[model samples]
Target chain A: MIGKLNRNSTLLSSIISIILGMLVGAIAMLLSGYDPISAYGALFSSVFGSASDMGETLRTITPLIFAGLAVALAFRTGMFNIGVEGQLVIGSLAAAFVGLKLELPPVLHAIVALVVGALAGAIWALIPGLLKAIRGVHEVIVCIMMNWIALFLSNYMVGKVLSNNSDSTEKIHPSASIRVDFLTDMFDGARVHLGLILAILTTIFVYVLLFRTKLGYELRAVGLNPDASEYAGMSVKRNIILSMMISGGIAGLAGAVELLGTSEYLAINPSLPGTGFDGIAVALLGANTPIGVVLSSMLFGGLFNGGSNMQYVAEVPFEVIRIVFAAIILFVAANFVKQLGNRKNRKKKGEKASA
Target chain B: MLSTMTNLLETTILYSTPLILAALGGLFSERSGVINIGLEGLMTIGAFTSAVVAINTGSPWIGLLAGIVAGILLALIHAVATVTFNADQTVSGVAINFLAAGLAVYLVKALYDGAGQTPVVESKFTDLAIPVLKDIPLIGDPLFNTSPITYIALILVFVSYFVLYRTPFGMRLRAVGEHPHATETAGVSVVKMRYVAVLISGALAAIGGATLSTSIGSEFSATTVAGQGFIAIAALIFGKWKPFGVLGAAAFFGFSVALSLTGQVWGLTEYVPSEILTMLPYVLTILALAGFVGRANAPAAIGKLYERGSR
Candidate 1:
């Protein structure tokens, strides 16, 4: 269904979804006896308020884009990798382990840590993807279960292997850090790093990988119709695993950047870091396009970054932003515009159904 | 040793009540042809309302009722979006979760002067040993010495089974999920059935959350429900959409959770790492799904949109 839309209509529908989401948010604010205008004003200024704020916002957007792409890639392959959060956790743990424990030179160290993290993520996803391919198990259930498993495993990692604190590990080596000193100084002490550049490069790479390559065509074809693709001599099972692994790698990158670039250490938490579920919203909102994923994640990044300011400046709670995003996703999911288009093409689709 | 066994059983029953309730909730919704990953959201709303109302009214019953109503109200959005608007059910479910989560914290903050959690409620249910049954041996203690909600939940599985397999409504609801087109041709309103099922799903799942807040825990916090709703969904699938199957699955999961913490169940904790023990339920769930049980067969049209006149 996502593949059916032209680029322009996809953009138009997304804009409509965002508008609807904002309208719902405004109404929620008003009904709560809060001024929506002031809340929105605070939200705007929160991102544009200062150079540091802008840096933080960019940093926030980076992980979301990676997570969104992870979701979008699987979504395009007719798979729902609900385990992106699990993948992220494993990846982050791996990257943190490498960054903190291993001693190597600057650039090579970071690269090795990143590669290991992405591989960890891929391995984490491999379970569900293989199950889906070989045993016909639905990815949703396994992925959801894997999320809790990841939490426990990461907690153990933090507690046992790298416990400088009860709930957190020691910081990574500076050589393995992604944050550039020049960038930090430019942003007035912001911890914003080159992760945004990595995210953008990934976006471009994936866009090419998914659209411009024959392998991309094969992956998408399996997603659109696996039986037909198989009839066309494509190995459906292999493609499913391959797509899932690639998506898992990207999701791992999200965690790697988050830890290596932002936290520089791992923390043991009872809950997920939460990007996987949000990735579902980002991918849906972005219409599952690479460029769209980046754009939509920026919107999410801005909302999340601005939420505290909204709370402080307008006396509205930060959670109100979740409501807005939820509304946007609903609008996008219930795309009446797509229905209108579907109605127009029904004759062709109906004939094909019969044929 | 017998007493220790009984205590473990009691803990399992207490923990399993919410899972059983929530899985049954999933049973109703999925059997009616609508996907409801929003059980977590519904439970959250239920839990928050239950906690708040219990605090204000000093009556757990009223709070519980109010929680159910809140869940039903929130579920109405899901019903409208999926049945009325033909929205993607999974996406709609995700939205429902976001709405519930945001609304819960948002309201808590608004009501409590920016406090992150609710104060403990004194009126919540406490564990009870049934008068007649308490006199019985080890078996009776395990079976009866539990939260009253556990007994209600135990009875509910049979009730759910009867309702799903015995009643005319059950047949139509199943038909609606499996083949809405056929159900429609038989002069039944697929939309109405889905709405009823979803509301019931919301109510039960909410009660599950309320059970956690009011009975198991002393208060409502963001993490109180934790991922129990998702666990309930896993139980639903693990149970293969059957009430009795879900009861057993939930009990097993609850047992895993209950024993994993203390390692008193066969003293496994002595040998196993606490982390490994904690990971047991999820790992076991995956193994169960991948093993001889094979794939869980959902309703034929579980995730598909049911258009009235279109194929």
Candidate 2:
């Protein structure tokens, strides 16, 4: 049944599925005695209501863009980097520590802090990658365990060492703070900074690197079939490590943007942050494409920003958004399974015909 | 010194119970070829359901049963997804986790009028003291005087070990996981074995949750299980997926947790932030997984779809 569906038609079907999912969500809201229209209206208004609201949405989207890209990149390489949450936390802490201690010009300080953050994330991700590559450890198990370590370690460091007797880290030095007075002025006191531009550039970079480069081809080939890639003379082990490092670096940059652009300080209890895990769902929904990740990030950001208002207006709990997200994941996963089934059936038919 | 030692031993046993139960649950699923990543979520559901039911019915026994049933139901979702739909086991497991969490929270709010918790219950599991055994010095109270669930869990460990190694059923379960087609060709029903194993996994995990609510906290909280499910998974791997090995790994993690909390009480490491000590289990998990156990082997068909028409 699915083999008959063209690529364009499948894409259309997926879009229709999303729309149908939203409708189902609306029905759920209505069944629960909430005004679905008003709730959705509040959601859209909250995200695009005013210049300030738009800025907040953009600020939120900035880090999501990087994190989503990070997760998507790893997914393309057939690695499930569940440690992105941990990587992001450690990266943020690393950048915040560097940002607070550094005394350089604003651009240089910011750049240095971001680089430190990315490096930290890369190093953090490398542990699991190395375990997978050399020791034959499953990345999922290692990454999940590493996330806990990162969370606890970062919490301890922020609480005991960098906290200055407070719950949060010392504020980043003036030089390290990425000021976006230009955009702020344009938006009349909005927090949207140059990080958005950087995020977009990073997305484009990821796109080109993944699709346009020989290295990207090799990485994708390794992801598709490690044995085949090895047969074709691709170094699967090196590609695996390189892909993970790049994945972690992107996620780490996300942490830097969140700290420097929005949070401006580090909190001791940076549990999960939701962005890293949410990135998994985002990447899945986006089909692990750069453009797909951006659009999916926007959808997720909107849901988060809107869910708050939905709670305010409908008196429904904000956790409804989590349900919605989970539902989408379930549907997408089911779709993937169905697609796999179709492919298997097609293969069998081809074999029979040849025989 | 005797009192401190007894306290430490008691704490270790207490912490190890849940880990052992959950890991034993995971053992069933993974050994049967299904990657039970939803173990955590199933445990959560079990914990919440058992707590709520126990509070309502004023029967710890009934609550325990309900917890097991709740866990089985959730595990069934995972079974259907991976077994029938052939969905990605990890993704489906994650989806189950998120869904269970959201559904549980939503139900709590809806039923409790947004209190985010159920009211405290009067009924809970009381520890069983072996009549003469409880009179022994030091080790007696900590070891002999405990909840019935502890003894049940210990018995389960032995039973599971025997089941996994001694029985024809055990042989078939392992065979299906290692080679489903071969098992099927040998006239064993692979699907039936997988279904049973996963269901058993769910029930055990749920019982673990029930133990937490009825024996430890006497109330259900969102963070009650708090990644204990993942700890069980680590314990399973750390123990090389063997039943007794998993039990030992669970005890090891339990010791770390017990030590951390005990350190706070004894003022041994009071100056150090308790969070660092709390993180010891996960840190240890990563380290153990990184190299200590050498190469961990998963079932050959462990997350792969077993389609009759395909392979």
Candidate 3:
């Protein structure tokens, strides 16, 4: 019972860490001579003041949900897929390519574009996964390299081939769009689309696949103790590949959603979309859980969407929001470190008593 | 034709200086069992700090020192998180990276009343010809007629090789990375060694960043460091984490950069797309990482948190 209580306290402690993260940001605001209260007020008002505001927030949440789910799934499988951003760019480009090039029927066009986008993401992730499994290369290094490669590849594709003389590709066909007329009308002509529904359903599907399924058991088992799982006859290599592919596919879906539901064109991006990097913070804050990821992603989406208002009203730079996000990750990691220290002390005490 | 060859060599040398320094920095930290993925962030801070200071103090040398100090400050945060609190190294690294990028931009806004970049410094580390070497045949102009930072970067490679291989402290550093338990049993402080290694890494990486702002780019922008720090990390891995190997890998990467830049200068831009040329170095890095070239092993306890009195 005490052990269980201790675990609950740790969860509470994470909440406290989050609050502390906000406090740190507030302190920074104060140091910059900006009123924290008004800043936060503006932030909230921006995200929740109107239906259209909520629509914008939801639009931001759509991709974040997919990206966060991608990170969470991979984290649970004990692989840090830092290549999510790269995969996302690849996936978005693929979706854009298909959406622009293909002449499929309306319903079939959108589906095929999304599927192909996910396929491209999976293929991009497979390089790192296979390298890690077969060549003993660190996934982080490979992923970092691949991220740049993807950027360049996407830039090249958008500039040389798909582009209609501009740096961005031609507008994707309307048939391949994920826009919903009723939803757009409901949001007062806001940019919200069917991607929100798709994101929520993907979250539910991911949760079920992670918890209710046998494959999840093997994956989780391998994550916990790969050596033990190997002894139990699990193919760790195959699972690593599969986990990365799934993670990449989900990240790819985020790209497709962003393209089909929002932009409808692929632009030559000099830098990453940053959604995938944001997903790391989301996964960390969410404790790598599906429901937790959705909640935390919503919070982050609001922060991002509302940052502009905070900037306009409070005269605080939008960069402060990024600092706050960093602080949150920092405090959480610090809390984790403290917990690790406690566990080590307890283990030492147990050993001493045994001796 | 000879001049073009010399020009390529000069460009390669200039480009490799920062990579060499940053890779050498990463070598020290990872060798001591802490992965410093925040190299990019550290470099950014360094670039920003050095540029701002150089503008204020009117001395590139002072700016260089300021950059090193800034790097050490950030590295100390990482060391505290990883060594004291025993946080996950990579996550901590990511956080540090984000913090640096954000903090640098925030500071730029605070100090300069704007974001995106710092004011340009008038004083930069310009290239100077060596007394006698500049007059020599083919090699002199490229090899010796360079900025002081280039010389420092090259000399430091040997200096790091000596300190990391020949010194007693180096042995303990390697031992702690491989077997901290044994090192602790031998009365060496694992935490202190790790702190020293991490701090050194920060200093060198900062120097690399300072070199960029002070000489290479002549100013500090939000994208000044870009992905060079990561490329340095890849170079370090490709070099098998050795000082001389890092020098070679940095040069190789530098050569690729020079080649891409040269294509346009040589009026071959229409023949080969600059984007394709730009993609070559990254593709090579991925291929090298996939063991298409060879293999390199990391330190045994590279990412592990050392706990005292544990099995």
lDDT by residue for model 2 over A1-355, one digit each (tens)? 5655655565565566566566756766677776778777777778888877777777777878888899889877789987888889888989888898768887899999989999999999998889888877789888888888887888777877787657878788878877678899876687888779989999999999999999999989988999999999998889889999999999888888788878889886634676787888888778788998899889888787777767777677676677777777766766743566578999999999999
Better of 1 and 3 by lDDT: 1
C-alpha positional error of residue A217 in candidate 3 after TM-score superposition, expressed in Å: 0.9
Cα shift from native, residue B305, model 3 (Å): 1.9
lDDT of 3: 0.88
The positional error of residue B84 in candidate 2, measured at the CA in angstroms, is: 1.0
State which candidate has the highest lDDT.
1
Place model 2 in a CAPRI quality band.
medium
| lDDT tens digits, residue span B192-237, model 1 | 9999999999999999999998998978877888888888988998
Question: Residue by residue across B186-300, what tens digits does model 2's lDDT show?
Answer: 8998888998898999999999988888887777767777788888998998888899989899989888888887887788666766777777767766777777747567778
Cα RMSD of predicted structure 2: 3.6
CAPRI grade, predicted model 3: medium
Candidate 3 scores a chain A TM-score of 0.93
TM-score of 2: 0.92
Question: Lowest-scoring 10 consecutive residues by lDDT in candidate 2 chain B?
Answer: B287-296
Q: Give the TM-score of each candidate.
A: 0.95, 0.92, 0.95
Candidate 3 chain A: worst 10 consecutive residues by lDDT? Answer: A333-342
lDDT of 3 by residue, B14-81 (tens): 89999999999999999999998989888888988999999999999999999999999999988988
lDDT tens readout by residue for model 3, A1-355: 9988966776677777777777878998888777899999999999988888889899988998999999889888788988899999999999999999989999899999999999999999998889878877788878888888889888988888897547888889999999989888888877999999999999998999889998888878888999999999999888888889999999999999899999999888767777888898888878888988898899889988898778888877777888888888877877754576678999999999999
For every model in order, what is the iRMS? 1.5, 2.2, 1.6
Candidate 3's displacement at residue A288, Å, is 0.9
Per-residue lDDT, model 1, residue B198, is 96
